[model samples]
Target: MESEYKHLQIGVRAAQAPKERRVLHRVWKYKLMYLLLLPACIWVFIFDYLPVYGISVAFMDYNFIKGMSGSEWAGLKYFQALFESDMFLTAFKNTLIINMYKMVSGFACPILLALALNEIRVKWFKKTLQTAVYLPRFVSWVVYGGIITLLLSPETGLINKAIEWFGGHPAYLLAEPGYFRFILVVTDAMKEMGWAAIIYIAAIAGLNPEVYEAAVVDGATRFQRILHVTLPGISGTIVVMFILRVGYIMSAGLDQIINLYNPMVLSVGDILDTYIYRVGIEQFNVSLAAAADAIKGIIGLAMVLITNQVAKRINDSGIF
Candidate 1:
């Protein structure tokens, strides 16, 4: 029994020693880094993690006066109501359609833009072009939407004026449901394409020059080198970004859509976030909004997991 106890102690100590060393090494050697990260840690805890408790409001008949603890537990009533509502179903469908459209088109545009920009040999021109394209991204959606409204106006807008000059009829683009989704997708792609391309450009920049030299020696043309070397080099970055994008498949662009859309286009433009805002803030149905939020979170979590698994299977790279 004594010998057995001795052996057990030795094994336990051996297992714990490495863990202790790791903890101590992190504290001792990387204390400055940890200090630098402290503010971000606090901010995340306060803003992100702390608000997670509010998720419980989804299961309760939340009342501002009663507060969280005093609110009556209503179980899944709000969730049931949400799933049964025709308006919510419409919003959910619209959200998925719009998000998928944006995902497919928006995802490809940045990569193409990055490749085109990468081909520019003139440094000053490339920098100027990059700056010019990226400026739109920094513009607030409200301001950009106003600009778009003016540009697409049937009477005084440049587009309609051009159409009239060409003997075509003028059209109110934003007011038409058929044209709204197209406008949303195209405008969003234009706004963010430059900012999105920066990541791919950085990935392309990190590729070794030796690979290009070797390809040149093998008589590869510029396009051939880009297709073979540049793309493959940045495949990992693309995969990672794509996986992250998939995680947000449920979230249609709320800010842009809210600013640009009107009652005429609400049939196609009313998305989950906008619906949540209407129910929660406008109608004062707090529990219903919480339930909608909970559902979105669950779907997003599942998407991330499934997408990561798919990415791992296909390319052996994933966010996980």
Candidate 2:
């Protein structure tokens, strides 16, 4: 039995030796590339994976002084609290509605912008127009939000002044709950559309020029060429972007909402991120906040997985 075991070990080692040598050879050959990647791997570990350990706080009655080790095990207590809380429910609903609105408008706007830009024959005019649209994305949301507030101001806004000139009542649009989500969706699209169009434009540029020429030779109109050649060429990028957008459905533009929203519009504009900030940072209810955040993460992850599968099935391509 001992002799047979020794023979088996020897055979296994003999088989593994060549594989191990090949791995070592490849590593040595790519040493420079590996070295370049080391910093990125370290950064990901530190910033992304290291925080994963703290997710346990969601299941614990986390105490600052008591620390993680001394905290009481609360199991699903916090998660239950999250579901039961009226504020959380409102935030959850608002998050979904707002993100859906943004997704529907935001997704189409960039594609349309890219297509429109692609059709422009005048280079200088296209560049100037692109710059005008892209400039909004560079502005900080704080400054942008302040600008929005000023524009919507009832007494002194340019919009109000224009309305007054037209013999209309100058209304405070920001304070109205009905208008808050619409403003968020429109502003978000305006800010992001040009920037997001860059990828689609690049994708369009990468399409085969011969295919477009063939379409033109076949008597296809400009719109028909775009439909057949351009759209199909960039469909993969579109699918990947759509999947990523769906993954963040739970996020709902925290920065934009935080800067734009007030007490009056909170009921309509409040999202999970803002709710978590209020509970965790301001109120210091750590466990409950953690649980709510955990739910967001889980939902986002699930959405990504499901969307990736659906995208693959539909388009035969995905981020994966």
Candidate 3:
């Protein structure tokens, strides 16, 4: 019996050795590829992973003179204060409202634009339209904001001039709270719609040409083909992108807001990022800022997980 058991153990070890050797052989074959990836791994480690340690500042007094190691621990003191502050609540509310508006307007615009562009038979016309829309994405928000300011200027702006030509009163669009949110949503969509459509267009391009041919054979009209074939084919990509967008529900375009917003619109336009900058950088309250950031990160992470799970449940397509 002992001899039989010993022989079985030897056989198992012998079988495993070949599998181990194959894994090592494959690794050796791809050694150069792995070497190419080394720099990116190091970069992520230094820039992404290393900075995570600074999250500890949320629980500490975080004095610049004392340093991180020597800083006094406060144990959620800043977090408690943040929760009770009116500014934080206002910023949170504004962030959610603006981001939700952006999600609705900005998210659907790209997909619709891509579908429209795909139907264009004239290559030159299509290319020209794409270029015109995409050009705004490359323009810095600072320059674009200045142009928008000039265009929306009540006195000498083109839009106001046009309004006057049409016998309508010229109003200060940016200063009015009612129009501020709408401007943010529309302007953001316009700036990003073309760039966002590029991904969907690529996804559409990858669809099997035979599928559309079959749809045509089935007597599907152009719109029917788009509805039945193109949309379904790219639904997975749309879902993935939607999940990512959901994760950023807390981030309300700080650069654009900061540039376009003024004291009048701050009540409606102040978001978490801008609020964090004001409190942390301007006021020198490092701990409170860190706490706010930590909360945002945690909420964003939770949103990604929840949305991914929902996507998987619906269609079995998720980022995970």
- Top candidate (lDDT): 3
Candidate 2 structure quality by residue, lDDT tens digits, 211-305: 99999899999999989889989999999999999999999988899999999998999999999999999999998888998999999999999
Pick the winner on TM-score between candidates 1 and 3.
1
Cα lDDT computed for each candidate against the true fold: 0.94, 0.94, 0.95
Runs in model 1 with CA error above 4 Å? 1-17
lDDT of 1 at 59: 96
lDDT of 1 by residue, 207-303 (tens): 9999999999999999999899999999999999998898888899888998998999999999999999999999999999999998999999899
lDDT of 1 at 158: 95
Q: Sort the candidates on lDDT, descending order.
A: 3, 2, 1
97-133: candidate 3 lDDT, tens digit per residue:
9999999988999999999999999999999999998
lDDT, residue 133, model 3: 89
Q: What number of clashing residue pairs does each candidate have, in the order they appear?
A: 0, 0, 0
| Worst 10 contiguous positions by lDDT, candidate 1 | 13-22
